[model samples]
Target: MRDLLPPGVHVAESFGDPPGAVLLPEEEPAVARAVDRRRREYTTVRHLARRALRCLGHGAAALPPGEDRAPRWPTGVVGALTHCDGYRAAAVADATVVASVGIDAEPHEALPEEALGGVALPEEREHLARLDAAHPEFRWDRLLFSAKESVYKAWYPVTGAWLGFEQAVLTFDPAGSFRARVLPEAVVPGGPVVFDGRWCVTRSFVTTAVVVTRPDAAPPAPCGCPAR
Candidate 1:
């Protein structure tokens, strides 16, 4: 996962359940009513997030979710968190060097048939079909889903607008990278319309990440529309 990010970003990741992980007082409310599984995922990711923060020479801080349910990072920091069966990870960077960071992990398996229609554009599906035929070992459909997720994570913090599945066209390279071209309908003034990201498939998971540098980072003047 660390290899997926660019320099100046700090990342921490764990596989399987986090042993002895506990939530801080400020973070407990967010998961107050969550089941054990939810609590575990929440606790583990926050723990890793703080660890990444510490690596950046900052002290530990509670990461509560804002009204939008995105983590409220410390001032001067931009970051992202992700969790999936058997995996939990966090990445953070100084806002001065990195404008924003987004990362996601998913099981290395085919996406459910019904989901592909909603997640992939027609061209993206065609591209995936060709990749699948030539590189049958990779779960191209699932990797596409993960790539879009990483794009949104990077997009939302800057645009504060929803990027629908149909709003972006995606393409993949079998050599571990992908690109997302945000269509005009979803573009925001002063915000990036394209994102370049990387992907990795391990024995158990497929993970992707996007890092947008400063001068093109997020929290751009809100487009005045609520997140959908």
Candidate 2:
């Protein structure tokens, strides 16, 4: 997941349940009625989020969900979180350097046939078919879904609007990257917005991330150092 992001963006990931995970006082209400599995995932991800925040020099703090269910990050910070069966991750950056960040992870398996129509644009489906034919080892459909998830995560923070599944057209490169062309209908003031992102496939999961740097920010350092 770290490879999917750029410099100055702190990312943390956990596989399976995290030991000693507990909900902060402010975070408890959000999952008060959730099942055990839901509670564990939520708690584990927030725990990683605070750890990432501390890496940015912030104190550990509660990350309750906003009205829209997105984690309400502390002031001066921008981030995104994702959780799947056995994997959980959080990525954060100082708002001064990064405009927004989005990430997602899914099991490396084919998306259900019934969900293909809802998740992929017609042209995207055609592209996936061609890719699958050439590289049967990868699940193109699942990767497409994960990419779109990352796009939406990156979009909402900037636009403050919902981006539907069909709102973006995506194309992938076999070389570990993707491009999402946000359709004009999605309503960004500047019309269409194109997001370039990277993807990775491991033995267990397929992950994708999109990071938008602030136009006025200085270049990041060579290492994965957090922004000053």
Q: How many residue pairs clash in each candidate?
A: 2, 0
Using lDDT, give the best candidate's number: 2
Residue-level lDDT tens digits of model 1 in 1-228: 887886678888889666877788999999999999999999999988888888666647889899999989999999999999999998888887787898999999989999999999889999999999999999999999999999999999988999888899999999999999999888899999889999999957999999998864553331221100
List model 2 lDDT by residue over 82-113, tens digit each: 99998999899889998899999999988999
Residue 46 of model 2 has an lDDT of: 90
Clashing pairs in 1: 158-218, 158-219
The regions of model 2 sitting more than 4 angstroms off are 222-228
User: What's the TM-score of each model vs. the native?
Assistant: 0.93, 0.95
lDDT of 2: 0.88
- Give the Cα-based TM-score of candidate 1 against the true structure: 0.93
Candidate 2 weakest ten by summed lDDT: 219-228
